[model samples]
Target: MSTAGSPSTVDAPRTAAGSAGSDAPAPPPAPRRRTGGVLWTELRRGVGPWCGGVVVVVCWVAMYSKTPQWQGRWTETTDMLRSVALLLCGPLAVAAGCWQGGRERRRSTGDLLASLARTPLRRALLAVAPAALWPPAGYLVAAAGCTLATWPYAGEGRPFLSHTAADAMALAALGVLGFVAGRLIHWRLTAPLLAAVTYVGLGIPAYSESPARWLSPAYQHTYFWDRPVWWFGPASMVWTAGLAGVALLGLAARRRVVALLPLTVACAAAVVLTHTGDGLWRPDPATARLVCDDGTPQVCVTAVDRKLLPSVSAALSGVNARLRGVPGAPDRWIDGPRTPSPGREQLEAAPGAIVRRVGEPVLLGPREAQLPSPFGLAERGRVSDPVLYANWAVSYLFSRNCPGSGVDTPAARRAAAVNDAVNQWLAPRPYAVPAPLPGDEVHLRRLHGMGPAESRAYLARYLAADLCRPDEVPVP
Candidate 1:
């Protein structure tokens, strides 16, 4: 009772050091680390995997459908598959990327993601990686499967790995670019708009005649028969990588304006690199050079068509037998200059060579009767008259000398009249004629019934007649 309030406090057990009113705060818990589980969850739920699967299925179907076209040639198979993949997958990947980027905005998660300790660039990369990577991965998987299937039937030349890689890179770059666009533009229609734009941009170059079309990743008009310079693959890869890099840099940069510098430089470099020369590709010597048969009446074909050499050689040898000793007759049989197609075969005359197509039907049927004497006319059952074909052949081989104008002209008409007259003299017999001829059947019969000696002399005079001077040409 002597010390009052101070004596009373000391007497107590002196409970904890802070009495009952302490106000100290506890330390905050540590931030969560970003993990692969998150990435997997995103990939599983996002459009990337589904889009990739769709792309794979589409490519498989397309490749299977065109099996007849590519089965004979390895380079063509790979090149065509790669081109189709690029054309279809590129647009789909871009659309997928756009949808992926727009998902966050649609969910209103921008603020939430930004508030996390992870940097925005890292967030973007993690989010966009699945879309950017999956399409190309799917494409490669499909390509591998296709190659394996076609391996047994494939023709000469190995697959062009460099071109395939370049195409894959371009597809990835498109996906990344689409992601960036989606992230920047918050419109609901951005995904479809971007996809349409990308498709049109890529497609225009394919149809365009300009050399600058090579700049487009989707502009793979060059076929397997030709090859670009060695530098083309690397240049394309660099250009596409640069495009993707610019998108990434732009997303990560603190200053938006500075991010454009790399993009601008890359674009200029790409233009220069892609514009390698006046043409996108040139003939490959290994494929284009003549591979000749080891025999008389030498038969030659491009290396790509070597598989058909045996049949081609046999066919041309028959034609050569009939053409022996003729002035300006072809000494060698070579593949004609024409676009490759199935069953659409043709032949043309060249200096010292008769250029014909492989697998042509002209080689089949009656050996002597179907042998095209000139301009590829034959005396098969389909012909209206054998004499008509013979006379046409003679005039075409000896007299006609105009370039193929592909239109009706005076020179062509006059040449036709001379052939008709010669045909009447040779065969007075008539079938289901398409039109009436100038001479009567009795007169034509008299001319046709002539003796062998007189007939041979008459034919000599007829063949020697000048078609240009129509009035002077002999008629029945």
Candidate 2:
């Protein structure tokens, strides 16, 4: 009792511990006690997460590098994402799925898994889940990242959610098909080889003109201003999902006849898409509708170009100054298709003629002049020198659609020189004044000699004169 740490005391404590352990119910088996069970084990330890990480990295890097090309337009942004999903994401998913499918065999666990009481289809489903599902999850994350980047600056339209869903479905199909391929092929390089082959397969149809090209998920789109038909996205989903379902059934079903249902569904979807073709797109009324600026000689642009209205109005200030209240001048400067719409009067000042189609084919109706489409003039939100375009517009108004307009004749040539001189005075080019044409220097000096008011008066007389008829043209 005096020696408190004796062997007898230690043995007493050990005996009590053993008695407590024996009295308590034994701990449940490790499998029963596991947090997420065996499926979690497969997902946690597999390479699937790495594949998803790879997808996000590739998408982010590609998208970041070309931000200017797609950032300000919802259609452009969605298109860019779709392209990446088809070209890069599809291949990556295939490769990752293949690797995952072959992992059990690689680890010599194929025999153990085969001997398990679970059916082959159930075992395969558990194995394929990480491969088939992870890629789509990764794609959604990537799409969200792109959307966040685009929302602040995107103009005039909503995100193409259907297109995004179609692309994700395509990626899942690719992953499932890849897993099937891997389960069948035992070669170590099968995953990478399948990826390369799949890339070529997806690409070949993109450049094709055949309607069958629509069957491929990689098909290109047109017109940032155009919207896809409402059912196009859902139909695309059915097409891709049916294909993936068929693949999965083929790999795991004891009765492969079950695959025919998905196969038939996929065939029907393919047919519908092939027949639909470009009919899938329609002009978006919101984008195609005209938005006008409050300015003298009122500037009008399509709603898609609403943001550019201020800059455009500012750019045209000099031209408006010259043309305002001038006889035969345009009343409304409108931007869109070159061909005039029905019931709309187009003031086409061809040198010898001023063709106007008012309600009664006369000049009395409000004059609507066709302005060049601003789409080509601006790039990545940076507008080019507007003065250059203004110069062209003025010169176009001056040019005569003579029978020999295309040919360079002496009289036509002289008339062109005079026309060029007048254009120069109206809208000065920002840079590189070309060496003067015949009589160009003289005309320029004469115009420069007059006061602004006198010059403006002279310009009016010059425009009213038919430069196509040399006798009708006024001397500067």
- Least lDDT summed over 10 consecutive residues: which range in candidate 1? 373-382
What's the distance in Å from true for residue 368, model 2?
A: 2.9
The lDDT leader among the candidates is 2
Query: Whole-model Cα lDDT per candidate?
Result: 0.62, 0.77
Worst 10 residues of 2 by lDDT: 356-365
lDDT of 2 at 224: 62
Each model's TM-score, in the order given?
A: 0.65, 0.74
Candidate 1 C-alpha lDDT tens digits along 1-476: 65654646554655444554365566688976557877777777678888878878988998877665565556666667766787777888888888877878889888998998787777887889878888888888888887777666443466667777888788888888888888888887888888888778888877776756767776654344566667677777877878888887788766767667768767876787646543446566677566678845556655655554554455445334444443334455544223432223454433212122232222211111222321222111122334444343332233333245245655555545556655445332235364634344444566667875665566556545554455555554
Runs off by more than 4 Å, candidate 1: 1-37, 221-225, 255-265, 279-282, 293-298, 311-329, 336-476
Please give, for residues 313-381, the per-residue lDDT of candidate 2 as tens digits: 877889898788877677877764333332235655433443322211112234666555554455444
Collision pairs in model 1: none
Please list the Cα RMSD from the true structure of every candidate, rounded to 1 decimal place.
Answer: 11.3, 6.7
